[model samples]
Target: MKKTALLATAAALILSSMPLSASAAETAAYKLSIDNRTISFPDAQPYKLGSDVMLPLRQTAQALGLKVEYLPASKEAALYGPAGTAIVKSGSNQARLADGSPIEFGADAAVKSNRMFVPLSFFERALGLRTAVQEDTATAAIFTPEQTEAVVRAIVERLVAGEYQQLSDLYFDDTMKQSVPVEALKAGWEQTTATSGELTGTQVNQATSETPDQQQFVVQLSFAKAKAILSLNLNADNQVSGLWLKPIAEQAETPASLIEEEVIVGEGTKYPLPGTLTLPKGASGPLPAVVLVHGSGPNDRDETVGLAKPFRDLAWGLAEQGIAVLRYDKRTYVHGQSLTPDMLASFTVKDETIDDAVAAAKLLKADSRIDASKVYVVGHSLGGMLAPRIDADGGDFAGLAILAGSPRTLWEIIADQNAALIAAMDDGDPAKAANEALVAAEFEKALALAGLTDEEAKAQTVFGIPAYYFKEMDSRGADQIAAKLTKPVLVLQGEADVQVYADKDYVQWQEALKNNDKASFKLYPGLNHFFAKSADGKVEAQVVQDIADWINRP
Candidate 1:
């Protein structure tokens, strides 16, 4: 199959992708924080230079309570903290500590946009502060002498002791008090303990922050029946801002009747993907098979979201019914970190999902034990949206099953989702109007996608994603593609799903395929996006049975 320049630009809108440029100053890829509080850079944000975080000298030094002097003629900066005075030269990895001892940075300090940028390690090594960086989230945090792990430990102790009133009075800010009152906190704890059994113990897992003003501590709580996570949020002033307790669900055991074999999709190709092929044990004849494709983001073969492993459940459940199932890790999941900016610049849905899915389908057809004529493709979310295209792009499946997918363009659905969120917000909220205007602006950009040249699309970012990605998929609406297909299609939706609405998205699929007598649609009550009962990992057995019954029907 010939690959296109189009990539999963919609997925990039929600999932983390490599920045379009390698120049950290241009991309501002790293989020800087101090003492669990996010640090905002009004002019130049912190960026990653190799493994090191580069921060503007003056701003970072001020944030760290240090005095800084810059010598522009020689391009060097001297930082004065209580520990000592350190001198750093721009475009050099070598620096002198407060004690005049020579020190080296992981990467060279540089000047960008008239600002001298120094490695984050300078504060740690010269000023005697502690620092850590999370590469996955692109976050860098610095801890001062005033900030200690003991602070979060004390907060956890107060929570475990059930001193809601004291916690509220001493720790919670006015906003937090209104949002999570003492009574509310007590009731929440009671409800949690009642459902999850008494909290035997608690462990502070990690401390992090999303924004500049708020810090968060994730605490793991052990219960008699299950485990739960408590997210404790604090403001820069050390006041409690938010609190949430969610119980973790245990995963269902895989049945013994199923046999899983390790397989490779797109073998000997540029991007070979590892996959799992699940089949029923002791089956007598060639088995009907289906390939399971993922939605947005870098999903594992199991499509594990929180506790619900929907793809794994489907693969096991279907195998038990005498069908073989193929599920593979998404290409982005396997190779996203390794992809260069050039590779992602022209990358499209074909590169992210479709090509690998087609490869998996072909793999199934080659297996002698599998009945090639009965092979099908089951796509969830983004995968579902691109199912017909996958078929047109050489999947040539016996049938296609779409779960919780939209027939509308990806950007249209995103716009609708934002509009829905704005509608649900209080009219008096100051943020509501701002969000509305932002959505409107994004919608306008999305509208302009079709007219832009390839270079323009690649250069512009719409709705936080590369415009070219959307431009590539502009010609391939799921509904338009599905309308041209002669193969049978099964469209399943969860009525309660908030991400893809039943009335808006599912109904369109029904309308588009209405003339196809072989098309089937089913809506499950009280199910969410995963066709699971409230993300607890309990996928409706009926959903699996329905797909199996539909495929096996005469």
Candidate 2:
């Protein structure tokens, strides 16, 4: 059949493909950009098929925000985009998108390096996504979801295996190769492996500046003894220009005066959250209790990020001072993502934050070891903003403690954080432009949400969350809610926290609650958002002591 002959021809060309030489391929890298931001690919390099650029299939779909499912039985792959679906068969140049849109490609889909390869033109024609390839710098400012995973996997495997020479040859640029000698890299890997144990798994914590020309991937590699972050910053030439490891800070020695317990929060709920309860070791009577709440994101009870665990530090440090403390994993942290589309559509802060916190407080109040009359809530960042809402929902807390709390709208806070992060980046840094583009996109999404009806918002997603969630949050003003609460309030602000500006957020809190005599505020001069000691790079002991004193005060 003529079809069989076409397939054979495509196969013959691919089988004869040769590896690109370093000298010839030095500037042969390709860049992919979607919505004007660069997307970086680490493992699968782009190659040309005549005049068209080709990419690994799965990665390309992911970059385009499409979900892919391969049917081994049929030798077919289905890509589901937000708007439609596309189907491609192996060894065929024919494909179809949703609505029966036909695609005739010059090259047939084939398997290579254990991945499916397809032309970028398929996405451009079928999904209406924009893509470009820059052969000059071997850059593509385009991103697909799969490329990120592949890159992270490749880097983590190489680092853990202690393949320093290969890494230098494959990933490092001229400056990086000169700076990180192979012996030094090998010794570093040996020390890290010996300390952390054999590599078990890796998770991509974050990806930023995903333009086709450059990218930064932060990965959390779990080892037997501990976890460490391997951050890779790649340049236009697809070389590792910057590389570093960030390990979790060791917890300060637990004082003899304190004890920590693992417990469950909201036990009867659909998802019973796990938590840590810290109390004085030898308490003979009921002790005052404070329940710690995390800021935004899927945070553990410790609110672990990078090398910091602010909540854990707070829990043990306060318990050492004779105060009982409780901190639980966020709902979204455990059950938020597993929910069905319908469930997520209706998700809001009420379920994500307020409910579990109220449950924790009720549990604490009922505990024989806790003084029900003195139960308080300590909310940091997003938690702090919702403290009043928690109380209004019958937390019946004795008081509220606000740390790095923002009185501004949640979206405003997010925008400010994005702006600050972008400002901190250096000029001409490719990441800066990409991040700025992301910020612009987020703002556009937020603006679109402002006009949607509540019902419509429920059916949509913004910044990767259900738009209804934002609608519900924007409907309630934490500052207004806090102003009406009669409970004693303690507000703590870090003057140096650019994430939540002290001059803006702290000042707004003081002004809003000035009429409420039960409210008080404390401002630390040099502390950052996490209350870490800027000089020593750990959560300051004094900050913990201050919270304990504020709670213990008559």
Candidate 3:
């Protein structure tokens, strides 16, 4: 299919998903308001259907400075605003946009006692507004663009301030109230704060739900004890229908055989990346060395994810097996926010992964304790996929070991990742189709980077990345490059890894390197993308031990 058609189809799939229903109540007890001013609905109050909040058409639109028109003969109601006009009729599930295109509503427009009631989602799309329902004072706050972030910030403040009673009373829905009582939630909050330490700061990213009227804000809170990502979803009534907090994995106890020393990659350069070097205590000179490389995202030497530190595990385990390991913090991890727009335009895999990786390898080679000819590269995920490229660029490595790598392009993996996540969710999950479209759109944007200049690339972004980044990464072929290399290759995969499936990514590696005598493959029975035993399990000892054995062999 053509790109445009593909995107359009994906978009339609996103819009067609209706929000899951909380209750089947036709009317709610909440009052309506806009911009802090209440609108008293005489004889009819705001109602809810599934995930949608329906309001009295004429008064709701007019209070927001929108011109409303109703043609009784045609049984149609229209809202006219600065951006566009929306036309909807009672009992209709489709709305006509300003461009006269039809968009499906999460719920049908309804009429009772000669008054039309329209879904808030309709106005959210056509008129670019936000709606929030608060049950405490029993008011629904219909707002404009500026209030979205502010609403989320206010809730976070309440959470941090320990105002549990007010917060629960103000925002929590029936499900939240029932599942987690006020006292229990407060205890959990206290425990989190006590365990994770005081909140240093928070970074927030917003996403609109498939219903459009609802919004979700992902807030990353930095604490002294741990870092956590909190996901908060607000319905049209501004009630927090869902909340999730995932804290970083706690670091495991230090190993006895390992001795750690701090080192810097590209030392004395503008990009001096700091890291840790792990070596077996009392080991003799000229030991085999492995430069540890991280996957995508800003990662520390440990390659910390949730509570698991796979890199640290590998480093410690390998050191126990008499190998030296060098692991460093990524460039983007330390100085990402400091980079300017122009700098990001020029940022590529070389700056992100390759150059530093090569530097680390050279650092390993220069060490008298590490055998110069026995230096190898161990890359995980994105790092794994690019290990061959790193080897080709910086020769003299003993071999390359890839863990949970994919032979496909980064964009393809991104699309697959989203699809897999959506598949894991319930079939009726409203966010599934919307997230899929978002991923598809991101890939489509990546496809356009080839013909763009530096300036153009700087102005355009895909998945929050500059087009130049994709342009550079897309040029290298991981499988093809690995196939051409003369060095021995070790491929490792986990059968239970949903992120990079064994059947697809591992199979690709096996097929691509089947003819090469030096290529070897190992598949773990129950490991995950991070080489963990289960969804939340720690890095398996066997996996790390096997890698140690592989590095030690001849």
Candidate 4:
């Protein structure tokens, strides 16, 4: 299976049975380009089947339109455009685009999903994307419109809210009238602690005056238990003018020091996975190990996107409490190689995510300091759905803790995903027609294959299954295997997580585990998918910050 790790095998065998000569195998290769520079793929002889040629996906898809990103570890990606965002990936390619329906690029490529797969030339021509033949290099210019008063306010709010590290990437060089580096904000981050505003407000009025070319808005901020205000300056375009320095009223939670020792876990391994294993300061014997699996989006070890570092905070806090914690660098962030969108369609559950989880679980089990029998898995969001199957894999694990998991097929989940995301947006209009049409088409595809139904026209699903419902179905026998789940399960639900709401999904879980008694479910009254407390499930709830509400350290 290791050498067979090539991606195309699952559906590829169904594609071309023709045995091409070795020379033709060499000719039908792919190359990746970034701003006319080569990133991953190159002019090599004999391209292996099913390899992903990851240049920036955006540069390959038509510009500023809906784009897709892949996170191999999580086994997912994000698709966003004027419509909304859909999570795309190798197995579950459900994210749909605007007028950009899934279509084939030619015999050389096809879109078995919303993800577009193209020959090397498509990348070169589509987005001015190109790779250098002379050297292994990547080059791309990020374009941004000038920041407005609205944009700057939003940026400072995020900075004040601990959602972003820097605003530089958000805007273009031409639009950056002025700005401040992170160093200048150290003092600001130190102040504002213990202030009532530190818990409820972002009004950091530290700097009242503006430099000759700037205006400042200091926002109160908190992270890692430290609280402070962010001083943002305004430029002529109403963009960020510059960064300001302000003395601190108090510094509540400063890192012990920035000089942290970088420990490389897999010392001699190439492409060694990145992660941190935190063991309690004092443990008498081998302790229970918990692997913190991330949610849907491309995330870092911290799971820091938007205001969701709950995973990182949990890892550190729990490890301190005697439970060992393990979290890894998501494939998307690992940065060097990315699975191209083209290769994603043929994906299945085992091909993308399960293997990585399996590898990590085994890696931790082998450690002398860990109790293999007590190895546990705690998955949040999409990882939650994946946990049961992981348990079904016959691994050495204590149990599963699902933070907002689902029991329905990912295909049905996509329909719900579309409804939820669109409802949360300002547009407020349901793209129901588009969603329905896609469902119908998928069911027809299935009916044609199974020959089990003649009512294809009115069929959105068959036998309780929706079209494309199993678009990424691997483990077709999971429900059959559930009869064997003797371990305990903790289902943590957030009443406000409409995207994967407990009422719909948790009920499905309840039914599937029907007569089983080893299960427990807890619904956090006001939490959302991010596990952040909220009144109703809405995108805005994620933006409102609360320190360590959904997670508690060991």
User: What would the per-residue lDDT of candidate 1 be over residues 112-149, giving only the tens digit for each residue?
Assistant: 66667778776555454556776777887776545644
Tens-place lDDT digits, model 3, residues 5-69: 00001111111112222223475556777756778866657776666677777667655656666
Instruction: Give the C-alpha miss distance for residue 394 in model 4, angstroms.
Output: 4.9
Residue 237 displacement in candidate 2 (angstroms): 23
Each prediction's whole-model lDDT (CA)? 0.76, 0.72, 0.74, 0.47
Off by over 4 Å in 4: 1-271, 335-337, 421-470, 474-480, 534-554
What's the lDDT for candidate 2? 0.72
Could you give the candidate ranking by lDDT, starting with the highest? Answer: 1, 3, 2, 4
Highest-lDDT candidate:
1
Steric clash pairs (candidate 3): 132-237, 132-238, 133-237, 133-238, 249-306, 249-307
Off by over 4 Å in 1: 1-251, 268-270, 340-345
Weakest lDDT window of 10 consecutive positions for candidate 4: 1-10
- Per-residue lDDT tens digits of candidate 4, residues 202-271? 4445243322223446665444443434556554234453443222322124123211123333445443
* Model 2 TM-score (2 dp): 0.60
Candidate 2 lDDT, 63-133, residue by residue in tens: 55556777656767777644556678666677776667676765666665656667765654454343455
